[model samples]
Target: MSESFELADADRLTVGTVGPPGHRVFYLQAGEAGRTITLKVEKQQVAVLSQAIAELLADLRAPEAIAAAGELLEPVDPLWAVGGMQIAYDQDDDRLILVAQELLAEEDADEDDAAVGRLRFTREQAAALVARGEELVEAGRPPCPWCGYPLDPAGHSCPRTNGHRPPTP
Candidate 1:
């Protein structure tokens, strides 16, 4: 377990750990005094988001890539979405802090903007493209436009190339 647990408020989100030996946990603490709707979060969601973070850090450390991974979590439950979450890395303390919030429906614009900026594709558009690609694969036909010139498991040998021979097994 990481040292610190993330924290958040309606106005802002914060991530920080208390220090070593602390276990990561998620909760929906009550607001000020009395609130009709309480905040919500799940430990599983945090685990999922953490995996996304690891993936984002695998190849490159670009801010845009980080933002893209954050975008992928947009449709995820707001309480667990890491968009606004802050990460604090303290080697000496051996702690990591991550903050998040459960945005209200009125805040959809913020979520939309974040996702569009990263993927350059709306949710609907992405879904359609995926569906089309799946159809092509299922039919064992030529690759879709997006895939372009599919390759064999071994090496590629396409007769369509200039003066090329037919593909051989």
Candidate 2:
């Protein structure tokens, strides 16, 4: 059975990437006390998660100023790749809850065998995560103006052009 973590009142929760631009690998990390849990995630996941968190925060009172998040901690090893994720607000505790489920293999017999992680953090942390997520995403390769796909540093063959002309700069 895979290990799961419940980081209630986590001290740190953030998203970070490894490698350069087009070859980047994104990760979702949460830590409490001395324990840190890292999960592999996709670039699109980070972008969508940031948008969702921004919308959620907008519906409630704004959070106070938060300290800028630092770079990813050393030994960034992910326990599992994230498959599905969920976010919700806990009015009673006045905290944001993020739950990430491990990606299961196709041949796995029991769906319940997949590990799950739950992180409860304050609005400040959530806001910081949103900010960092947006920054990381924007730092990557620019998107194609026509097709909305990532434009390769070398060159891109945008489908919108039907290969009749070069990709839009």
Candidate 3:
């Protein structure tokens, strides 16, 4: 069985990416003390997570200033790829909880064997993640005005225009 993690009162929680815009790999990282858990995630996941966190924060009073920016910890190896995630607020503890489940192949028989990670963080950390997530996603290649698909840096064949016109630059 894969290992699972529960990071309570985490000191660090952030989303980051590596590689060029068209071929980037996004990651969600959380750590406390010396143990860090990195999970491979899709760009869409980051975007949605950020939006969700922002919505959750909107219901509460304004958070404090964001913490100082920090680079992704070294050895950015991911324990697993995230298939699904959830976020909730603990009013009593006044903390935001993020849960990520490991992605399992459909052919895998035992769904319960999948690893899971639970990270509890402060509102400031959540705000920082939202800001960083948005920045990283926006830094990627611009989208196609016609089809709303990401335009390739080299070329792109927009479906709206069919194959008649050359790819957008």
Candidate 4:
């Protein structure tokens, strides 16, 4: 049988890693009408992400939620130590946001390991993230990857950077 999860009011959840560990970091955001509360942290993996969400859901309020997420994600992910959190936003309105920390799974105990995990995204959430990406692209922003710098195959120079090599054909 196929399983299903219903994410009610998905605008209340934003998940991702913060930055390098050794510091308190995690990000969470909850939107209302359109805007949301957002949080950022250092390094958090799937397992840690799960716990952080659970805690945030329980808190309901904004600050506590962010604090919990930050605490959980305070440590860097041993494997993919570089990741950050971002919450979707709708420019038409404003809303409350939250942030939190998280922990990883047992299988990912080492700093150089990979683990498979599962997450459920509601239709609205999926669409929102996608739309956000599209908006970025429309704004002359490059799609996500390679140090936040947009990649241009036309040998274009980047005003935000210098002395960079273009992707190899």
* Candidate with the greatest TM-score versus the true structure: 3
* Residue 77, candidate 4: alpha-carbon lDDT: 33
Q: Taking the tens digit of each residue's C-alpha lDDT, what string does model 2 give over 37-99?
A: 899999999999999989999997889887666678879999999988999999999899999
lDDT at residue 31 of model 3 (Cα atoms) = 91
| C-alpha lDDT of all candidate models, in order | 0.30, 0.90, 0.89, 0.34
Compared with the true structure, model 4 gives a TM-score of 0.24
* Better candidate by lDDT, 1 or 2: 2
Q: Ranking under lDDT, best-scoring first?
A: 2, 3, 4, 1
lDDT of 4 by residue, 11-130 (tens): 334444343322224333334444343333232233344444344433433222221111223233332222323223222332222122223356655523422212233334433433
For every model shown, what is its TM-score relative to the native structure?
A: 0.22, 0.93, 0.95, 0.24
lDDT of 1 by residue, 17-40 (tens): 211212322322212122211223
Model 1 lDDT at residue 117: 7
Evaluated at residue 53, the lDDT of candidate 2 is: 88
**Residue 50 shift from truth in candidate 3, angstroms:** 0.1
The lDDT, on a scale of 0 to 1, for candidate 2 is 0.90
Off by over 4 Å in 1: 1-39, 42-48, 53-84, 107-169
What overall lDDT, based on C-alpha atoms, would model 1 receive against the true structure? Answer: 0.30
User: lDDT score, residue 18, model 1?
Assistant: 19
